[model samples]
Target: MNKIKIIAKKNQKEIRIDKFIKDNIRQNISRNQIQKLTISGKILVNQHIVKKNYKIKPLDFVEIEISNIPTIRDHLEYNNIIAEKINLDIIHEDEDIIVVNKPAGMVVHPGFGNYQGTLIHGIKYHFQNSNMKNFHLYRSGLVHRLDKDTSGLLVLAKNEYSKQCLSQQFYYRTIQREYRALIWGNILKEKGIITGFIGRDPKNRKRMTIFRNDEYHKGKYSITYYKVLERFQYLTYISCNIKTGKTHQIRTHFKYLGHPLFNDSIYGGNQIFMRKKYSNKNIEFLKTFLKILPRQALHAISISFIHPKNKKCYFHSPIPEDFQMVLQKCRKIFLQ
Candidate 1:
């Protein structure tokens, strides 16, 4: 149980325990929440259990304990999305949020072609099994999204208030997010920032493009800061920090710098870039290894943001297995 402590001051007036708590707590704790805490004996006054109507005096100490509520099992509302049971790698879970380590190739949410087998679907199924309340309220608690091919930490809200709080952080760009990717070609600079206007491709509707000065007004301006972590003969592992979340900000910006992410087909990464001709044996080996990781080699390695209910707490996600696996194989080959 989480605990919160409040002390009455010399100028404090005789008020109800619930009102004192509602006014003193940092979070927007409601009167109903305090009453529920009282029923569960979670509210204490001077180390003794107290009712909601208990009057507070100067120097009175109030302590509150919060625990997950036990609710009856309810079926998940499967609205055009199937909540099928699947193996989910849940990283962390609290009363207000859930952090998931999403694997590669799993769509973050359902789309036209994918009605099942999404991260949202699997997580919702797990919640249904646990019989947790407020977890099914959202579009399955998903507040943000990742590309189907990109893998790593993703956070989901458990209730309406938490959702709003998390969404606001992302909207204001206060959240810290960093991604690691294997890009084709060696970077000339150790670190640099790429600024460009990003928008849907004028030539192809399926892709995003970088706009020039004349076309800046037509596209949304975006910024990406990148630094080389490890370099290889034909590829480099880089970390990217995105300032503006356009459709394909990271991939498009890297391509604009002439280095698309390895194996990303949509942005001209599939072709053999950079190095000149190679031996047939080397070509065959590279092709086989690339085929093993058919999707783009990008992972959301780090994410941090304030907790919805707790002002001092922050959330984080570590690198997943797929990203490590691909990195290992590339390092083994390229470093040799």
Candidate 2:
């Protein structure tokens, strides 16, 4: 059996026992399974079995035991993940790793409806050119992932050892990621943290939603830290640091706080939601900015991780042009 241990940290209070375990573990164990494990004494709080409804307190120690968890490669079909020649914005590359700046609209790897022309396909082409033969397509060295429409830095490993080392870092939450986002409205707090569980919206299959504190059984625990960089008349430019990388984490967190990301159609930022009354010119000007930024106004700006060579490395990517244009227009119109 594989053992998973967690130390409840700040902002993780009053979370149900089963919900806490589900949020922290990567394995697909349902709450019912967790309840079974608790009854079987496989899940424990402070070395003692507790009821599933028991709330986790700060600094509480939780341990879970379960069978080996299957990795992505184990269940995915890699036979169709073929190589394709495409341009990649490589920020850094070494024998052990390849760090690439993934552009917005590019899927990181092969998946349903996106098997070709992915970053993995391009990486395979790159590996072939570099004579790194016999690399597994599934093990194409992706340490982490970004959304298809989210531009950011991603590091891929060249060998199993490198993959293991990097993947462990992510598993231990040692990797650091930072993002720049333009969210709707002028938030009052200069800096704040949003904490919640994130899971797929029952109403919309394509989107994710932030579960309330009481709805712990619904989603994975997610935390987002944001600091306002610039406050515009109708929007706010902010820097985000995510403690937990859940699907649509930053977007959902901001939306939960009533400030959806600018132009994030799925999260309700595509249309105006702040105030009903604005001058026609202001509304049209906002529409012009939205046209400038066709996607959610978010960018992965920086990342830091431990290299396989036992050295620390940091990488940064400038906000892409479309996002930059929106910022410039906002500054010109709102600040001036």
Clashing pairs in 1: none
* Consecutive 10-residue window with the lowest summed lDDT within model 2: 67-76
TM-scores, each model vs. reference: 0.71, 0.78
Model 1 agreement with the true structure over 1-336: per-residue lDDT tens digits: 467777799888998888888888786667876765664455767655566678899988777765322222212234445677989878788878888878888988765798788887787788878876334463655666788888878888888678667765655567777899889888899999999878789899888998997876456668889999999767788999886666778989999999999888998787767536566666676677577778788888777889986564444566556557767877887788
Model 2, position 56, has a per-residue lDDT of 96
C-alpha RMSD in Å of predicted model 1 compared with the true structure: 13.9
Which runs in model 1 stand beyond 4 Å of their true positions?
1-80, 133-136, 275-281, 311-322
Overall lDDT per candidate, in order of appearance: 0.75, 0.81
lDDT of 2 by residue, 1-336 (tens): 487888899777787888888888887778876765564445667645566578999988787867422345443544456678999999999889889999999998766798698988898888888887666646475657899888988888887678767766665567899999999998989999888778789999899997776875556677788899998888999999987777899989898889999999999999975557677888989999888898898899999989989999999999999999989888899898
For model 2, what is the C-alpha lDDT against the true structure? 0.81
